[model samples]
Target chain A: MKYNYLNGKLTIYLEEELDMNSCKIIRGVIDGYIMKFQPYELVLDLSDVKFMDSSGIGLILGRYNLIRLLDSKMKVINASKNIKRMIELSNINLECVQYE
Target chain B: MNENYIKIESKSRSENIASIRVGITSFLSTINIHFDELMDIKTALSEAVSNAIDHGYGQEDTESIVTVEAWIRDEEKIIIKVIDYGKGIEDIALATTPAYTSKPENEHAGMGFTIMESFMDEVIIDSKINEGTIITLTKTIKKRKSNSKKVE
Candidate 1:
């Protein structure tokens, strides 16, 4: 997975299954970017993500914490139905962001 | 039908996570469960295994084994167990509490037990301070009735 900083927003493109296997890398990358670039907002694009487990949830929540610390916003886009349901069950708004 | 088991042992490396996810999903799908139910099972199982690898094993290079067992009972209940022999949780009660994690530096949300409790019908954890841990979860499937009176 790779993340890019553009237009004052940090966009992360996820690949492969977002389970424990990829969390370490994903977390490291996102945190590094957040600290270095300090973007005004964070956007996680999950168009290519095929699977996500509870660890994935933890990863997102951790990012949410960081974004809050920076007084910024975070949004997810193109999440799969399963991922969408998981997010919704966690009481996050799905319509605020686009779903592909 | 009967007891079906899959075991994978590796160092505390994160690479083994994919295998664990695949193993649990395959076992659950073979029994003809709903997708939502399967996702719940998978999520809970992944949390358990990740805890074993990340917390119990400390994400070290030492050998750690994560064993998963699944079985169907009378075609009604599905049971799954995840076992690991590593640095057993010192405080089972506190460990399972939400936002309580031994390793917070790894960005641990400490919601593993919370997710497990929400996903599974029943969750039991057995652990010893220096011994190991075993987490068992069971869920009963609701049968769909196809013989309901037809609407005229």
Candidate 2:
């Protein structure tokens, strides 16, 4: 639920559990930020995610699609091994998603 | 091989997920389940609860209840059952298939069952179209050689 913009890149530090609950709250607010800042390269930091489900995948994909609409790219950062497995077992399209 | 059990019934609300996580994680942590194993259980629990709230009640009926039962069968085994008395899936086989979800529009990748299967040693989904669904997840915790029953 937090983001930092530096050097024209937006890095979002998600320190919350990326479950259905956080997704709901995040979905409500992301658009506002997109409209306001309109950053092209976005990084999602999930180092502090306590728990994640399929909804977490949806959140990333939804944001990916959203940023895609803006002709931007979304890169992932600090994804745990379990989160990586979740994303890999999810939709094949997301298999190409990068993590750092 | 000491026995411990906990049963939790909560309204099908997303907010309650936190409490469920805290409860389960706290209990299992006391049993010396490793951090990664705890993460696996928490992830599976979230998926199960999410299924109950989203697929079961369609995330609308706050009156409906989601039941979670956890049984520590022994030092090395844990069983959890997540049950929902909401609309159940007609095809269990198809439902368990990878990338199969009725709520793709909502960004569900149909990885709930996939996740539960990966994290737990066994996952059994029992459902009937009108009755309800019960997903039983069993994980075998890696046995740590310790006679200390109390978490100190």
Candidate 3:
């Protein structure tokens, strides 16, 4: 639910369930950080996220698109097995980050 | 009355979605189902709830209610039902099309039905315009092999 920027990277720390309700806030925060920092890389830290739905997938894909536009790299870290499976099922690269 | 059936009713808002996943997981676990199968069920449940909130409830008010029911029949079939009373879909066929979203501005890919279909054994949708939508999903657990088969 909270996002921060540091060391040329935008780190989004998510808590609770990441679904349709939270996706709007997530998108807004990510967009604001991307525009303000213009970081060369965007890192999503999901250690605190207990659950994620397809809307969560949409959030990731939307950020991926934004990163592509800015010529930056995007990675997700600390995804649970459930989250990882959802990401993989969506055809996104599973090796893009080190799972914790 | 089956002892394995589980029911959860919460606001159609996104915050209550975890209840759906928890409900499915508990039902699956009681039957000794594996984690992978549970994840598949969780994914399908997530999609159904998302559709209920985003499409059914229009994702505007968090006060709307969404109901989810899960149960296992004869220790073989898992049935999950997600119901929402919202604007409802006038065209069920058009609404379920992959990559077709009513709210494209939110970057919705409209793959909820597709994901549900891919994960569950069968999907049934019942809805009436301006009334509500009910999504029923059924999945059968595959028997586990006792022999260990290692893959390279």
Report per-prediction Cα RMSD to one decimal.
4.5, 3.3, 4.3
What docking class should model 2 receive? Answer: medium
Task: Kindly indicate the candidate among 1 and 2 with the higher TM-score.
Answer: 2
Chain B alone vs. reference chain B, TM-score for every model: 0.84, 0.90, 0.88
TM, chain A, every candidate: 0.87, 0.87, 0.88
By lDDT, highest first, what's the ranking? 2, 3, 1
Better of 2 and 3 by DockQ: 2
Question: Model 1, A1-100: lDDT tens per residue?
Answer: 7788888898989887888778877888889889998989889898998778766767888888788899989887888887766665555433445567
Ranking by DockQ: 2, 1, 3
lDDT of 1 by residue, B41-124 (tens): 788888888888887777774476777777777655878887888778888889888767777777666778877888889999
Whole-model lDDT, candidate 1? 0.77
Candidates 1 and 3, the one with greater TM-score: 1
Shift in Å, residue B127, candidate 2: 0.7
lDDT of each: 0.77, 0.82, 0.79
Please give the ranking of all candidate structures by TM-score, highest first, separated by commas: 2, 1, 3
lDDT of 3 by residue, B63-150 (tens): 8888888878877788999999887788889877766778878877566787788888999999988889899999988954345668
Q: State which candidate, 2 or 3, has the greater TM-score.
A: 2
